[model samples]
Target: MRILAVDDDLHMLQFVAGELRQHGYEVISAENGEQALARLEQQTVDLAIVDVMMPGIDGFELTERIHTDYDIPVILLTARHHIEDKERGFLAGSDDYLVKPFESKELLFRVKAILRRYDHPANNTLTAGSLTIDLKSYELRSPNGLSFIPLKEFELLALLASKPRHVFTRDAIIESVWGLDFQGDEQTINVHIKRLRTRLEQFAPDVKIVTVRGVGYKLEADS
Candidate 1:
C-alpha cells in the first residue's frame, strides 16, 4: 500500500516514513501539506498519515481537502490529546486519529486497521436486481426508494447479496454475520433476517427471502 506521511518536522517525517517502509509499505514523505497535495495529484495514495500542525494548510485543512477530492482514508497525528482536537480531526474527515509520542507498533496497528476497514472486500456496495446498497454511506435503496436498516442488518444484507441464490445454513449465517465471538443463538440470526426481510419488503415488495425445508435461507433477487 502507498502511504503519504505529511509533517513539518523533518525528523518526525523521516522516522514515520522509514517505519512504514520497514512494514513493506510504499512511503511518500512531505514537509508540508502543499507538498503532500502535490504528491497526491501526481500519484495515487492508498492512505494518508497527516500531522495536525503544518506550515501552510495544516492537517485539518489537508484532511478536508483530501476527503472532498478523494475518498482516501486519512489518519491524523497530533500532539494535542484533547477531545476537541480529536473531534476536529474527525469533523475534518479523518478516518482515525493518534496522539503524538505514540509507539511505532501502535501507529502501525492503527494504520493497518484503518486500511483494512477502508479496503474491506465485503464492504463494497452490493446490488441484487433492483435492490442497491451503498456500503460507504450504509444506504439501502430499492425500486421504491431508500430504506433504513441498522448496521447488523446492513451487514447481513451485504453477506446475503454476496452469494445470491445459494442457501446459507442458519449456523453459517450466524457465523458470517454475527461473527464467532457472538454468543447469540441461531434464533438471533433468524430474527435479524426476519427484520431485514420486512425492511426490504417495504422497498421491493416482490423481493423474496427463500427458506429451505431443513436448510437455512437464500435471498432470491426477484420475488
Candidate 2:
C-alpha cells in the first residue's frame, strides 16, 4: 500500500519514510501540508501519516481536508502527550494518533491495525433482505435508491449486517467501530444504533436492527 508521510522536520520525515519503505510500503514524503496536498492530488494513497506541527495549513486542517475530500484514514503524529492535542486530532478526523519519539515497531503495529479496520471487503457489500450496504461508498442501497448515512451509523449497520441475527455485545461493537481507545460509554453505541434503526425504517422496511436487551444488537430480515 502507498502511504503519505508529511513532516516539517527533515530527520523525522526521512525516518518515517525509511521505516515504512522497509516494510514494503510505497512511501511518499512531503515537507509540509502544501506538499502533502499536492501529493494527494497527484495519486491515490491508502493512508497518510501526518505531523501535527507545520508552518502553514497545520496538521489538523490538513487532516480535516483529507477526511472530507479523500475519505482516507489518517494517523496524526504529535510531539506532545497532552490530552488536548489528542482530542483535537481526533476532532479533526484522525483515525489514530502517535506521539513523537515512538518506536519503529509501535508505528508499524498501529499502521497495520488501522489498515485492517479500513480495509475494503472482497465483495465490498453486505445484504440484509432488501437492503444493500455498500462498504466502499458507505451508502445504503434499497428499493427506494441509494441513501447516504452518517459514517458511524453505516459502520454499525454494516457490522450487524455482516452476521445477521448474531448478537454483538456492546463492548465488541465499541472496539470494532470506535476503536479500542474510544473514550465514550455504552451510551455511544446506543445512540448510533438508534440512528441506524431510524434510517432502516425509512430506507429498508424489510431489515431490522434488533435489541437483545441485556446483550446488545443484531440485524434481522423479515422472512
Candidate 3:
C-alpha cells in the first residue's frame, strides 16, 4: 500500500519512512502538514501516517482535513501518550494512533490490519457526469468518444476524475499513480499528465484536464 509519512524532524521522518519501506510499502514523507496537504493534492493515497507535533498544522487538524477532503485513512503518530491525546486523535478522524518511538513490527501489524479491514473490490469503476471510467476494460468514455488508455494514464485520469475540482499535488499524483517507491521526480508526473491531457482533448471534448498553476491538475467538464 502507499503511505504518506509526515513529520517535521528529518531524522524521525527518514527513520519512519525507511522502516515502512523495508516492509514492502511505498512510503512518501513530508516535512510538515502543509507539505502533506500538498502531497495529497497530486496523488491518491490509501493511508497517511501523521506527526502530531508539527509547527503549522498539527496531526489532529491534518487528520481532520484528510478525512474531510480525501477518501484515505489516517494514523496519528505522537509523542504524547495521554488518554486525552488519544481521544483527540480519534475525534479528529484518525483511524489509528501510534505513539512515537514505536516498534516497527507494531506499526506494520496495524497498517496491515487497517488495510485489510478497509479493503474494497479493485474491479469497481467510477463515473463522473458523462465521463465513465471503466476499471475492468481500462477504457474511458467521454462525449467526444472512447479512449483506450494505458494503465498508468488511466490511473492518472481516475485520480483526477475522482474529485473533479480537487487539486492534486504533483507529489500526491506520483505516489498514487507511480507508487511511493518511484525514484523519478515531478517531471515524470508532468509528462504523464501532459499525455493524458492530449488524449482527453482528442477524445473528450466535454471533459478537459484543467491545470492549477503551482499546484497540479483536475478534470473539469465543460459547462
Local distance difference test, per candidate? 0.83, 0.87, 0.84
lDDT of 3 by residue, 3-118 (tens): 99999989989988998899899888899999999888766677999999999898999999998888578988989979999999999999999997888889889988888876
Over all chains combined, what TM-score does candidate 3 have? 0.64
TM-score of 2: 0.58
lDDT-best of 1 and 2: 2
Candidate 2 least-lDDT 10 residues: 163-172
Instruction: List model 2 lDDT by residue over 116-216, tens digit each.
Output: 88774558998889999888888889998989978888888887887676667777688779987999888888788888788888889899988878867
Best by lDDT: 2
* TM-score of each prediction: 0.57, 0.58, 0.64
Query: Which stretches of model 2 miss by more than 4 angstroms?
Result: 120-123, 126-223
Off by over 4 Å in 1: 126-223
Worst 10 residues of 1 by lDDT: 162-171
